[model samples]
Target: MHGLVLAALAVLVSLTAAASLNAATIGKANSTNCVMLIGGEIVQGDFEKFVTIGKLLLPGDDGESTRRNTVCLASSGGSLSEGVKFAKYFYDNGIGTVIDDGQECYSACAIMFMMGTATGAEVSFANRKLHVGGKLGFHRPYLRISPGESIDSSAMQIAYDAAFSSALDLIAVANSKSPWSSQPMMKSDLVQRMLQHVGNDMFMIDTVDKVGRWDIEVFGSSEPSLLSEEQAFYACENSLQWQNGLTKGDITYSNVSDGPNGKRRSQSLSKETRQAVYQVEGLASGYAMESCVISRKKGTIFGCGIDEYSDARLGQGDCDHSNFADRSSSLKAISVFNPATKLEDLRTGQAVVAVQSGAARCFVIKGSQITDNEPCLVIHVGDAKVRGRASTITHFVWPSGSKTVLVQSGTSFEINGVSTGKRTVAERGDCYLNSATLNDFCVLTSPN
Candidate 1:
């Protein structure tokens, strides 16, 4: 990003003009590009700073052509919607930006740092550690355990939220839904934009490519988006950790929270333990996972004494424990069915030697962002909506680390950009999104 230096203390010096006074000016040396030295933990407030500084340098679409803006991210991530607003500014202005890896662009920073892509920029990294994981970051969509029976009057604040949320929303929402944006966002689209959303208003969420399918959404690694049966089963069945192993298919469910209740629950609902239950008996979970649904009233079947149903039975609420009840009803359980049994039990952040039993699976929670150097299969329960560097998705699809199933139907070919087995009921081949081999390429599958 240019070896030139621009200290905040420096910008506080050079940008002494009148019109730029109200603006949070950044420093630009010989590079002509603006450099913002981001420090301290990331906050939604910093995003406004990004916008103000960017506007100061590049002006707006209404003004002369916007100059490019580059951010030197060296802090932890904060706020999802805020980051998006900041990034949206760069994106709309056709500005390019970069994130030096040595400077930590932990959470929302990494996503917004991509604003450079608005002008065909790159999500460049410096030469340091890049921690990528989970989207329920410190910014946007704030939450707090309401005081006893006080869910409505819970002590919450939308302090660091940004003002550009409205304008950003109009553009992002349309772009997300636009067909020319390339891939249409399915209702099941797996785009995690909390980093790009606005307001700490969690309920005000956005959905792109609503034409396709989606399986689930997670607030983070440990919770579902809400308590609807749809939300419950969002990604339940897609959680497969192994091709074969003792724990591979040993499905377990626990602590199912009964709707807006939060009195305190300590139990889960799932099927009995069997040798083949969670195994790759025939290289399939046998059949592709249908949008299964479970229920205390409908789906509870007696198998090995415990009741269980297909992965579609995601939101089958059974836990009636008083502890799970809500007072003001604002603090409610988001998941009626938890797809994870022992996902938290695995040692993931460890540096260990490799083995190929494939028993452990990445924590399967929707909307929970995942970034890695190795391969991973991001299974969207219904219709899978995916994006990012192919490595982020391709590796997560099939075991080969090369094969991925994008938007599989019960049978038959879906559309262009997608290729199926030419059968009515066979699994899809590979689906690619602008697949360009060496660095880019995706195996695409969609409905025709």
Candidate 2:
């Protein structure tokens, strides 16, 4: 980060007496780092200037090890096409981005800032002599709906298509970058939600707390990485805020016991409403955990839901055991199952047999990408490939011919399923099982 700050100062020292470039500016202050300044509204030609300048100032194409690049952007935002181009430049160049004090990085500017992480670039804020308080914002892509005019089906279809295309571009940029270096900038669902969260078309990610929520590695020079493996597991577990209609008191607390070799205690909060929240703390297992919500009234469920399935945080130990979709694979299969009804809704009393999918003998999916495909479930039970989805998997027969059934138990353990007095089914007892999705279930005959 010091190198980044110094690079910024170098840019300030080299700028002309005008004090403002009002356009994308680039210059080389030293042998190791190039400083780029993007100001005003970003539009066409900025990306070309950035690339051409990088090639001119940075010198070698393989300066990845020797040369460091810092980019400072102050803009309101403009043309999504140009924003995409700008992001592509940053992703390709792996240039760091910064927003010093008094600088405004709103809308597309914020999007570009997030894109910086895709390339494993350091992004920060400076508030020293020439800098002001920094601001990073997000909003839905600019919509072209005419004022006071209703959109016809065809026009609405076109808008939806454009928005969908933008989402795909964002996902591609995120997936192209490795999670170890880049970290999760944001989840696909968050992108979709933030794009529609506000009517004014802006969602400012100004506070450190808000920025901490996203899959980001760097926020400011003073701030540390927010999406560490432990932090991500923490985020997955307690990330949900009690919303309207949900009372704070309705959420209860319970202590974890230290008796089990794995000393983890989970506090369950049951609501008069359909949702229930559970907080698991002090998990001893090396496996990571993610918090999930299930509807007691609904008969289906999915672990973590759309908001928690972070593609950017996938390989960062949070979901290391689960296999990922290949890079060349596109989400070609569309799932006919309505996720909410078929997944989120828990059956009246169905047993849940959650299993962790690791490199060893485990359940395999037909497709790697869960977002675009139905991923048919194939479990390796003994020497046979047993076909079953997570929800469809009901019974797990022990090696001794004893069977454990997955019954819908409000708490973690089920009493009626196995007839073993009180057998632990899922939850904190097994971290791998704790994180498994409703459709990711498998029967493990042995730990190996």
**Which candidate ranks first by TM-score, i.e. highest?**
2
* Backbone clash numbers for all candidates listed: 70, 24
On residues 184-235, what C-alpha lDDT tens digit does candidate 2 reach at each position? Answer: 4455544665566443456655422233345333322221111112222233
By TM-score, how accurate is candidate 2?
A: 0.39
Off by over 4 Å in 1: 1-34, 42-48, 55-68, 120-141, 144-180, 184-448
Candidate 1, position 14, lDDT: 12
Candidates in order have lDDT scores of 0.29, 0.38
lDDT of 1 at 50: 58
What is candidate 1's lDDT per residue for 70-137, written digit by digit as tens?
A: 44444444444555665565555555454331233434444444334223233221111111222112
Question: What's the distance in Å from true for residue 414, model 2?
Answer: 52
